[model samples]
Target chain A: MEKFDKLTGIAAPLDLINVDTDMIIPKQFLKTIKRSGLGVNLFDEMRYDDDRNEIPDFVLNKPQYRDAQIIVAGDNFGCGSSREHAPWAIKDFGISCVIAPSFADIFYNNCFKNGILPIALPQEQINVLMKDAQKGSNARMEIDLEAQTITTSDGEVFTFDVDAFKKHCLMNGLDDIGLTMEKAASIDTFEAAAAQSRPWV
Target chain B: MSPKTLYDKIWDAHVAHEAEDGTCLLYIDRHLVHEVTSPQAFEGLRMAGRKVHAPDKTIAVPDHNVPTTLDRANAATMTEDSRIQVEALDKNAKDFGIHYYPVSDVRQGIVHIVGPEQGWTLPGMTVVCGDSHTATHGAFGSLAHGIGTSEVEHVLATQTLIQRKGKNMKVEITGKLAPGVTAKDITLSVIGKTGTAGGTGYVIEYCGEAIRDLSMEGRMTVCNMAIEGGARAGLIAPDEKTFAYVMGRPHAPKGAQWEAAMNWWKTLYSDDDAHWDKVVTIKGEDIAPVVTWGTSPEDVLPITANVPAADSFTGGKVDAAKRSLEYMGLTAGMPLSDIKIDTVFIGSCTNGRIEDLRAAAAILKGKKIKDGMRAMVVPGSGLVRAQAEEEGLADIFIEAGFEWRMAGCSMCLAMNPDQLAPGERCAATSNRNFEGRQGRGGRTHLMSPAMAAAAAVTGHLTDVRDLM
Candidate 1:
């Protein structure tokens, strides 16, 4: 629920397509009802070897990408299995924004819910950003959530489209429930009218 | 005047009020719950000291955390942590007087499957769940979708939800589907071509002759991928086939009520003059048994097609495809048939129905899984598992060197102990083949159940048509 104005972070290039829910947090981690602490084991199988040691070759383990808050990934990121935990883990891991050529349907919405900005850029635009991310951990990308634009270190600017309603939502941190509560006065009025008409209350 | 489409009919019927911000307050008819996302919602409810407004409208099941084995007593003890999670759901549901189908119950399975089979998902209803596959219930011509945990709690307390309006997308599949092609193939083809995000912000209505001919189960398969294709939901008109499928179920209407229900259901279709915000038509013949060659569902090609060359796509997609190929340990221009697999998985909500099992078993009859290929068959539901066994499919799978296991979301999400070792490549019937979808660093190739069976027998991605 943290308000987003401007976010600046290192780009972690996951680069994998269909990084599904199971791989995001794994079903084993779902055992804990708590959504917190999953960031540590995000992509556990790839993050750790059989001996539970960090797999140095994994993108997340590289010293440079370890602190990445922006993830520049390939197409159809977050595909397979509809588990919201995938977004929860990604958000918990400090990834505030995900730039991809595309993303799975459910995961894309779930990202908005968890306050993670998922940007769907064209393949060419994503390639430029991915290369900027791979330039090393320090290659910073700046996202102005208020302006709805993402700028790479090389000064390439991309304006992605978001639903006007969803844009209003991210700006005000209003989810479905939050939006409903915003109509408290009207809801109260309707309830009062119904109670008077039906005498049910 | 706009003619009524099924999407509009359902949406209008469920709209309680239009709020100032243009969002609608929808009356939820059914709310399905599972272990993974309900705990926090339950905790929130208790913190607020609220009781469920409509307990009968809600149902819970344990799926994601349950182990897929008949030795439930042993499987129950496998994960102490998930056991506590399931127990919490059970306790919360009991306290709220909400109906819950626990793991030990024969009726327990994925909530989406159990809801429709039990008639909880009837036409003219609005269903919501904490899981995205909630869209699967839209097969019954309902406005169904997934919500977050906070929204889950809100629905539990009020039996109403606030939802943004979605644009209507009519995806019409004209002409007949070729013999041997199924609804799964049609949906996979659409999703693969559109990319996973193609349907975002849209309510996809499956129309035209091909969709109309599909059975309820087949329709469910199509709707299940609505989420994958980025649609809020996918719906099919409730015709006689739909009415017949729901008529005698436990929760469906009976006697005179049934007649009234049919009248309403009949009117849920799009009128001949109805228009949609977007319309797309695909010839049924253009679809084939698809397989994911890269990390995304969109990274797919026909079973007979070669891995795409780098120059085949526009923009930088060629490089992206090339990178995916490298990570998947595949080479461009290689025949998909030549790629070997280490495992074959034939289950998930996508293709875990009885028909899918029959399709795979038909191919595996008298055929043995190739040496060094580990294969397993996990049914989507206990009922599916039982039916497969009664038909002796289990014995065939066992005899063919395949593991016939009990039903849960096993290996579908690589949760629990059912996961491929690192570096393993599997031909999977379930949706998605993202990097390590099966396990850490595990590679997955998405295919049909019959195709997975074919791969099991060949130790490579062989065309299922060859087996046919």
Candidate 2:
């Protein structure tokens, strides 16, 4: 996991709604256990042609957005499948942030574990960010996790809320397993007591 | 002490540890695994030098990527990469001392189907799987939800998941379902009323006369689509129907133990005066056979309704609606049945049970599939396939010009060769209607198995009641 406090980078606009995990990283690319190298297959069906050539019309395929580090997308961004590979693909592709009007629950949590910031803002603010993102590589967006704010190149700012524990974990580069291990004694005690009280379970 | 909802009772019983920030470690009683998601988790375990702490509690099956063709009876003949994934699970399970049902096994099927059928998913247990439809187990009065690969690894290594509890919601459906309407219709109707994201952050409990009257199979069908409605899980209190279904399965407790288990399961329901964070009620009589007109599950309307115009929607959904109409190749105000389809699919975790197949067989007995339209039926499990064949349901399907497929999640997500060609439209009995879920540019109209059977014989989405 990578530590996060702030980032300023070019944001690409993906204006589609309900961008499902299947569309993010299709099942064909999910066979491998390794999370690395999936950056190439992100949106495999839409980004590449039958011959494996890049489709020039797709948002990420455009010259200016090829190396984008952020994405401004539509609502319910990661709607299907509980595959964590979706976040791995996005992060492996150099995308550190995803700004949407709203996000599906699992995907939103998965983003935090993988060091990707999934920011949910009101539709009006998302509309402003979407336009700012369409300005291509010239317009860099700044995200300050410490201050819970996203700032555009043209001086517009949007504030967002994140769970306190999640914010702390992102700032400290900690994950669920790591956090759980911190309280290993309590878990062990609870399990031992449960064994005695609910032996049949 | 405050009165506890069914969800609160389950949550309280499963907590292994709680942190100051409201995070708690919930112990999982059962963990179901499939090919697509577990390989990475197994790899993570290997990398971390950890072994499965409780292998007996976990079960694995390779259903997603395995081919359902009768010729390739085994997973050995699948695509190279797919074969590797299947074989990886087999090897990993053996190495970790976990039970696995490979494609060659007669017991093999979708993880969600196999678990309940084998009786590993019991009432009062907490089940977790890597597949979204894991909520299917919740029908047996369990707390179940899909977890990510990282969490899968954590559970395998620790037998517990770190999480915050979800809000409790009760969706009560009263009145009797109209003729030809099934549990699938009731669920679709709920999703239509509440948008796809409506149940987010909540664990929904399905209650009332309609829900209690449903068979165990029908209850599974309803709970299976809980994820589609954005709910963490959906549950039904265990009853006589649930116990009857779990009584004599392979993994179920026997004799004296069974009696003990039954008594415990009987107490899993909520009290009459229990409180919930949200309570929603719908009349079963009002729900009709449904078809999805757009990309999301929420973009649905009754089969009798016409396609909605984009301008009919407000907020940020107008653009989404317009795009969905374009992508679906549909026009505003056109009747749903007027949309022609090239194929019909009658299988998924949602509607591939014995009763579902029986319903379809009843409709297709003397009818033939429409000319130039392809139709297929894939049973939920090998057990279901064999039972259908014994009842001569498969014969009716084959006699009606529909291909009778061997078990593995045939065309649900199209991880294998079974899929629709681009631009092909289908009337499917699957849960999702998302873009490219079946295949790129492949249009899907979600319906009941009976409706799918009717569509196969009509070449379009038709209300099952019309044929009945």
Looking at model 1, residue B326 earns an lDDT score of 76
Per DockQ, the best of the predicted structures is 2
Model 2, B263-328: lDDT tens per residue?
778778888888788888999888888888898888878899999999999876899899889989
Model 2 C-alpha lDDT versus the unseen true structure: 0.88
Poorest 10 consecutive residues by lDDT, candidate 1 chain A: A192-201
Residue lDDT tens for model 1, B1-468 = 679788888887666679567767777778999888888778877876777867988998888767776576574445787778878988988999998888777787778778887888998788999887888898899888887676787788767776777888999898888766778788888887776768877899998899998888889989987887878688888888888889898888787677767766778888888878888889987777778888767777888899887678765466667767777988788999999999999888778888888888999999899998889998887788888999999988999999887777778777666888877999988776766667767889987788899899999998888888
Model 1 is docked with a DockQ of 0.31
Where does model 1 sit among the CAPRI classes? acceptable
Could you tell me how far off, in angstroms, the CA of residue A193 lies in candidate 2 after the best superposition?
3.3
- Stretches of candidate 1 off by over 4 Å are A5-24, A43-81, A95-105, A115-201, B75-77
The reply for model 2, stretches above 4 Å from the true place, is A49-53, B74-76
Query: lDDT per residue, candidate 1, A22-45, as tens digits?
Result: 567766676667667778988886
Question: Could you tell me the lDDT of residue B83 within candidate 2?
Answer: 84
